[model samples]
Target chain A: MQMTDLPPAFVLFAAAALLAFVRGKARWVIALAAPVLTLADAWAIIDIGASTVVPFMGYQINPVHVHAATPVFATIFCIMLGGGMLFALNQKRQVELPAAFVYAGGALGVCFSGDLISMFIFWEIMTLGSTVVIFSGRQEGSERSGLRYFGLHAVGGVLLLIGIVIVINQRMYAGEVDPLAFRHFHEMVSGWTSLSWESLGMWLVLIGMLINAGAPPFSAWIGDSYPEGSESGSVFLSAFTTKTAIFTLMVGFAGTELLIYLGLWMALYGIVYAILENDMRRILAYSIVNQVGFMMVGIGIGTELAIDGASAHAFAHIIYKALLLMSAGSVLYATGKRKCTELGGLYRTMPVTMWCGIIGALAISSFPLTSGFTTKSMIVAAVSEQGAVMADLGQSHNHLIVAWFLLEAASAGVFLHAGIKFPWFVFFQKDSGLRPPEVPWNMRTAMIIFAAFCVLLGVFPGPLYEILPYKGVAAKFGATVYSFEHVMQMLGLLLFSGLSFFVLLPMLKRTETISLDFDWIWRKGVPRFWNEVAMPILQTLNRAQKAIFDFFPGAGSESRLPPELARRIGTNWAVSVPVLTITMMLLLYLVVYFVVPMLT
Target chain B: MSDPIRKYLNLNDPKLIKWYWIVGLIVLGIIMAVDLAVHHHAHFAKDGIDIDTTPEFYPLYGFAASFFLVIVAKTLSIALKRKDSYYADD
Candidate 1:
């Protein structure tokens, strides 16, 4: 079929079957083909620009007219889907292939969706598909994690629906017959719009997106669930969901001020929790939040440079994060262990995996000659320029400076914990006698491809810069301050953190236990408090009901009692009936006497 | 054939330790040389490109001082490895 003639939904439907039917070599080919096909479709649709049409509910969904930013995000989503699919090809599980493809398609659907209603429809599908991917781990922990994951996402979907309804209703009240025909993208981009029902719609949409991005409170679910997924399943889990939220945020809420603070909090929270974590995967999961925080902050800054930085960071982060996780997953797959304590000395056998992991780690930490450095520098430089401009107005820009500094500090922490700590402890530290062979060639090939991109983007950022929405920022070669300062800061962090780890090394070791977080409210505290406190109250209520039933058997029983005349003798019946009738008449007389006078 | 250094440091031997230190120093030296020689770009011309000596130069000086502090901190970690698996028992 001609590329333009191929509908996006058609691609999804085809991918679904391809993912379901294939196994072994056939499965690998199907996995690889699905993404390639999706990418091609994405490119074709994006180029045609609202020209490509598909029928949904009797309405023609023109993807080309969907808004300028949608295509950019859709393009990246396609790339990530392809990369993640390739990464998962070597794993034996059949379920993850279909689950991941459906998940990717749902996200693409969201990106190309022209209206709020279409966006909400695809949003829920993405949630269900991702939840299934998590559950496919086939572990008890995964089952529980999947439940929590779905619960939070369901709530987010509800909130998003409410907001969409409100916005549509307001549009209707304003005399617009079709809410979907309203184009608010220009207003959001201009930043001059006032707060109204429409703006409230924007806030609701932002919260919904942040929930997926793993923002705090709601953030715990990503860390809780993604790590519990099967080694291969996690590769799927990592790519689509959070990045999709970021894509939405970029399109819908860029330049909003609240996102800046939210992003900062997420960045710091990730760093703090990661520092306290012992499980290798959880640490990486937290780092995902940390990395997304940078993008969030960039989107919030709203400058052309800042948005560009955010976009570039998202692209870089997806590749490197997946690479990191795959490396960890390989270790888990090979050794059947996930904790840092139970792992060591595998670098001898898994040197290829080790090096691949380190490259990913370095890229994540924004080391020079890595994708992270190329992209993240744009955000920091944008912040610096903002500080300079604000300083001329006689206002303090200390907060901006501090935020930038914290970002730098977090970068150091990433290297200390993830970059160096992961590879060093799991592969090179004290020996644990593990001798698993190198990972399957397909897995290694995926890692190598990602690692190559990490370097390629870092050494040459021009391609990314060109595609970025932001136009003003300068991200090019030969800037010494950017490179030198970041390197020195990273080194300093390493030195200090290294010293601290040694000083507290006695306490830093992994244990055969889980660390508590917000999930603790559900996992331990709530359950314990209920058993010790709420359960007794329930028991008391149960006992009272039982006592009431026992005391008045017939009162609560099914059988009816005989009438008074049947129970009594004839004389007794005559006297009781006359007495009862007289009592009723007298009571009625008394009621009339007292109640009639009072009414008057 | 066991080496004396292996017994003390629990590393491979004196040969390995010497090699590790040599390689590390060589890498560090190369990085420093590159930083000093290739990275410098004069912010101002000799007379034409006006420069703020106080505001610009001070931060650079402060950065240099902090950089040395980091190096010293790293040197302290040599005392820190702690008889391997110090926390392993817990």
Candidate 2:
């Protein structure tokens, strides 16, 4: 069949969900096969130019305009889905394979969706799939985290739905019928001279995309719950949700100046928290926010070069980050340990896992000859260029420059904490005396493939660069003055930073504790303080009000009973009735006095 | 010995696993030097031409920096390695 004649990805999504409803190993096989087939279908139709607009069940489903940028994202999501399934195969009892498949398939649907309505449908499906994944953890805190994760994502989905409705309404009012086409959707929504429906529509879309990107204040849900997922489930949780938001941002809100600062804040926040964290998976989870922060900054810059950088970084990050999580998952699987203090000298037995983890760490740190170096530099370089050209932008440009530097510094810090610190403590430090066998070959192979890609992209970036959206606009993959300087600076920074780590080595050792972050507000402080202190105070005040009401007996002729009985019965009536009467009488008296004086 | 010198170069104690420190530093230093001399100038450009940073200086700087770092880390590790349960149980 021609590529244009292909079926919608959502059909495959439904198939996966149906397969998940089945029992046993057969379900697992179906779950695994679904993503592989979906990936193949995506790859085949990625270059198809024709728009296939099918109206199904009162909604328009259009597979149109498969661009270079979108496919890169879709391709990575496919790869992540497949790898995550393989990693979770042994742990499939925690969550049925079909659920994971459906969840991953929903992400794939988001990738191929060509218009706003289709995007919103797939967006909610992605949220539901992820919440289920979190729920499957069945841990002490998983339910609450899952609920918060659901609540925040639902808010994002509602805003996206509102934005889509406004856009559709405006198009209908203008007598435009084609559902597949939106020529400059942002411009269309923003072109209104007044703060009308269109402007509201634009802001709604922007806010929706921002929430998905895990922008601050709303960003706490991710760090709160993601690490609480079942070991392998967290692997699936890591790949899609925020990156899909980033993908949407790339589609809808690129070049919006506000995102640059928002992205910068996320980058720094992740670094600060990750540095203080002792939980292995939560550390990795924060690093996800940090990596996505780079992509956000790139999107905010909105140049062809910057967008390509964002796209490439997302692709690289998903693989390496998943590999990192899988490594942690394997350790968690073997030792029943997720905190760093409970883990050490694992490399003695789990050498393969440790080395794979190191590769992931190196990639995340943007070390030269890893995927991160090739992709992250594009965004940094774009910011530097912006700084040089737009001098009059003044504080904005300075802020961008500072953000870029903070991002770089955070990269070094990530290397210190997650990269070197993680593997060094978990795998190579003083022995924990637990000699768990190496992970299964399938898990190892999955990790090795991702690690190999991290190195491959680092060494030979040409293939990846050629497929980027801004392929023609950015510097080609060759020797340049900036590239040379970048290499020197990277090497120097790594060396100096490594030296500093050694110098500070005495203080860098693991501790038997968890560091506080945003989650602490909900996890320990507010709930405890409110339950122990605030609730009792309110209860006491309520009782005091009741006591006052019991003591008072007011004027109505129902004083026929004994005074004690009257006080007891009338207390209930007296408090509310007298208060209401006194309030009304005071109002009436004031009105009469003022009006009478004025009339005289 | 003075504390600063002892911290940087106390490779005398056999119980300290000082050999591990020495071997790690030597291997890292050699690798850094070789990488500097041979691959220092390798780079990529937009026109697809491979070029060196300055034909002479960048690699030397990289090698020296890398060597110094590896040695320092190795030395520090030797100084810092305590009983296996130093922080584990505490």
Candidate 3:
């Protein structure tokens, strides 16, 4: 019954279960109060050193524990949940709220889980919660996209579970104490080049996390499904999954050498795909991949400063990305259109939304006076800091050097892809004559609060920097982050990049077309294969089985029974197909269990 | 039905659009000058971080990289572009 024993995740989960039965004003009150209460309880636990262990399954597990980085991620998650729920206040989708609770609940569970078993259980819960949220979009193809989203995450979840089992077994075999303890993967990430059992387990774990973080080939899920959500569903969708993956990566795979290469590819990949993309939400979705890439490089750098940078960047990113999505959602709610080709010249009517969208865009581009500047700058600085350390140590840190320049270049590209491009096209491009008013007050209020945070955190980053993993390192870098020289450099780079957009204005024209991506493999390739190749083979096999059965006389079972008796039985219990299937499967399994033992 | 806000924001007007570009050019010029006045030091330069110490290194890289990304995306469009309905059937 102790406050310390209650993991923050369960708090929302309890609320979710409660929320399903509540109606009207009571529901709204609970939605807001759940996060507020969880935040209060979470902060209390944090104050009590955040160490609370429970014994389950013969393991003493710490489900609510804090690392140096935990506070930063946990804080933003609470803030994001609060703001997201507020934005969704007026949404009539009955299931979206409770589903969001479960989604956020699961991610929160992962944040506090102190063991691999606990983490895996929570991770699967998140996949279910988010898939339901996508299905609740109720748009065209919502169910289908939700299915694909479910399928991909299910694959990721299986990889994670298998990795967890292997790593735990390996640790136990090595005679380690507390073998399932969730701690940093220093051995696996730092020494991945040497192939071994531990490294393979860790590599599997890393791949599983990479899939959620929207790292390439898998990056299409964000764009594919996020935009399909009901406007508010997307706001909730944008916050949890990828950012949680970043949190896990920062915790586990910091300093993994290959991440820098993967991160750089994501950075460029985000920009290129966004440029070719015609839908506004898809553009933002690509940029989410892009921003997460920045955080990945920071973790890959693996310095205290870099880790802090990654954590803080994740903190800042959730708010702004959600804010951007909120603005896009606002547009969708008002206009019922989501493509750039269909939206324009509404800045006159929707000044509040336009300004909020602009603020979010600027913050994402790391404009000097926004949260992106205060936070993302640390990661950029971390690369340089790590490069310096590497040079002094006489180690091969050329990757750090390459990473720093690519990051800076990517920063410029952010301005092009998201900063100006999002606001410019959606709000002020051609006059499509759609004159939607500003979004409703609750939605506007949410956007404004987040927009204010974007600017406030930029101006005063002390609160955020204080909570970063290596608190002192981030605090020290905070001063340099806003130096006149650095600010000028960022302005020069981004503003000029803005000019490049205008220079390429004619080339950047909107079209009702989508550029190909790795998703083509799944969305088109898999279905086509199933239709053209697999289905035909299966149909032929089916015909052959039917022919054999037709020739087999009474062995074809139905022929042995009277047709009238069979028809009577079928007609009587046709609704019990699932029951019949389960009974047969259970009988088969039981037979296998007994016979296998005898055979052995 | 004249909207005052639209009147102020309509850069589609030729004169207003001209002024917008002119102001933008002036602002970029001013910021470029500001970069000159500040003594920019490279975080990695003391440890032999060479290329970044060059004057306006970030600016040039930013411009070139953005330009490069745009051109690449455009080129990719020629091959990768499909009608918006390409996946609608699925």
Candidate 4:
């Protein structure tokens, strides 16, 4: 490999290593300088369209290569790290920043990976780094939450690895020269709606990516684990993992029809859950899923402009989501509170934070002059544009029509749940009799900077548009992004949504409650089933064994059992017993699926 | 050190809140009214789904959609909602 072909991820990796040992002002220097340097290096690589291939186990793997979407995603990942570091500067937990760096480094690494093997490696690195970030939060239950988070992502990573292995093996058998090339799977795009053995690997890959993107069933992990993070640690956590998955999906599975359905579900799911959610951070976490759903729809549309829209939206989403989280983090920093029920009337003492939070809210709602308006509108326009194209082709596009309407409805829903619910409940609702000062200067500076990006990109989206995968398409769309009719429609939708929030205020009252999601299957349902049903059967079986043993001549003499033996057979194994039993069951399943089938 | 914007932004101030709501509602009304004059291009013209172009369609849809979402969420809460500490207490 050439010296100039170094991956920009090394910059953050070096900084993360240094951050582990550095102290005082030097830590700040490394933290601030790392993202800047990484951005420059990333751009240089992107500008050159560089690639460096290394031989790994008899296969050529490009660990450092720029793809079409690299500039936008890599640039935003670097910017997120910088802004997140700024927000986290005052965080006394020494481990968060370094862990955040490693996490972001993995995300950046994924952006430049030109092969599936490298992508999977970086993907797992992200899971590891982010799990550390959660653990470092030291919040109550953060340990268990982090473990749960890690366990889910580990399963996702395994799915992706198995899919990669199968796909590469299939490609090799087919005599393809480059078996591991990470590019759009055009064949699957055509026949994506139905299942076939040939497309099984791609299907596994898509499910794995969807899981990371916070799609259904797996969606609860975002809200479940993110709220357990420290104020700023959650800020860092909110940006990287899902967006990176979005980057991968845009590359590999663009134009797949199923993503549209999944996206629509995620969009509405985020809103409904956020509406019932009482925790302020969880509310924002759900919105992340909601916004990602918009991007997913655009990727599914799979036109040049649509892909551009998804890329641009992911870029803008990261900034504003991080901004929103930072605002919430600041509130938590000042008051040590995270629930909407416990906060209100903070505008009296925390004007900076309140305004920043409001700006983030407006931006997220795609108000007339914010980043969300400039970026997210592209996705909406793409849906209509694609519908028109299908009409010209004389093909029925009923799904596209439904998708357009649902996306529009989701746009309004975003305003209600996140834009109105977040700020109104946290800053302007009935006073909870708490007066907390503004956050420290570093946090305020971070919030202001991100909030400014929201408006700046909204007003003059030229720079952001230029970096999109389809710059010409984005720039052409940017021309009409602020047209009078478009602006008015968005305003009418969002304003009326705001009105709805007030109109339905009584029904939307905050409660100290959590809504059970699909995770309830594992978190509550599985444990309950084991304890109440499965354990009883196992106990009976054990008792039957003991009875049979007592029937033996010598066994009857020792029926009382030794203390060690009794403890081993005890009923109260807390978590380990169920965990072990489940593990063994999974092992049996593996045996039945692979070894037994092979023998047959 | 003083927060001057608090005087107007504070929700606790009755007069300010009353005027704010009046202005906000008027803005929504004006946007809806303007919908009568402007012709919204049909997004799915080939599919003949031009209902989106009707006057005040956006505002009406926005209100109804959010209302539906809130009601649906509340109904779901009846079955799925639990004390925030449900998991922790276990």
| i-RMSD of all predictions | 10.4, 11.4, 2.0, 1.2
In model 4, what are the clashing residue pairs, if there are any?
Answer: none
In model 1, which regions exceed 4 Å deviation? A1-10, A51-72, A176-178, A181-200, A392-398, A471-507, A529-532, A538-555, A559-600, B1-90
What would the C-alpha RMSD of candidate 4 be, to one decimal place?
4.2
| Residue-level lDDT tens digits of model 2 in B1-90 | 245633333223455546755665675465455445444432223223333343323333433433343344334445433442332232
Most DockQ-accurate candidate = 4
lDDT of 2 by residue, A1-600 (tens): 464455346546666657756766776676667677776777667655445677767867775447447678877887787788778776646454455666766676766677777777778878888888888887656887788788778888898788777877777778887643433455632342355655677678778878877787566667667887887788888888889888878877777777788888887667655655567888888878888888999988887878988999999999899999999989988888887778877766787798899999899888899998888888877776666556544443656656655565656555665677677767766667889998888788888988999999888887777768877654463334236556655655555455455556666665544443454465567777999999999989768755755555653445345668767776434335556558879999999989989998
Residue-level lDDT for A236 in candidate 4 = 88
DockQ pick, better of 2 and 4: 4
> What C-alpha lDDT do the candidate models reach, one value each?
0.68, 0.70, 0.87, 0.90
TM-score of chain A of each: 0.84, 0.83, 0.91, 0.93
- Tell me how far the alpha carbon of residue B50 in candidate 2 is from the true structure, in angstroms, after superposition: 25
When summed lDDT is taken over every stretch of 10 residues in candidate 2 chain A, the lowest stretch is: A183-192
Over A261-288, each residue of candidate 3 has an lDDT whose tens digit, in order, gives 8888998899999999999998999999
Better of 2 and 3 by DockQ: 3
- Across A1-600, the per-residue lDDT of candidate 1 in tens digits comes to 466654364586577777698666777677677767777777776667535446667655444344545555666677667777776776677777788778878887777766677677778889988898998887547887798899889989988888777777777688975565424444545453476656676557667888899887677887788997888778778777898888778777777666777788887667656655667888889888888888888877767777777877888888899889989988988898887878887766787688889999888877778888888767766666666666667676566766665665555556656666677678765778888988888788888888898998888777766656643344342244245645644444444444344344454465554444566576557777899899999989767745644564343333323456446643222233344457779999999999999999
Q: What is the TM-score of chain B alone in each candidate?
A: 0.33, 0.34, 0.81, 0.90
Model 1: per-residue Cα lDDT at residue A595: 95
Candidate 4 fnat reads 0.76
Worst 10 residues of 3 chain B by lDDT: B46-55
Which residue segments of model 3 deviate by more than 4 Å? A536-600, B1-5, B43-49
Q: Model 4, residue A524: displacement in angstroms?
A: 0.7
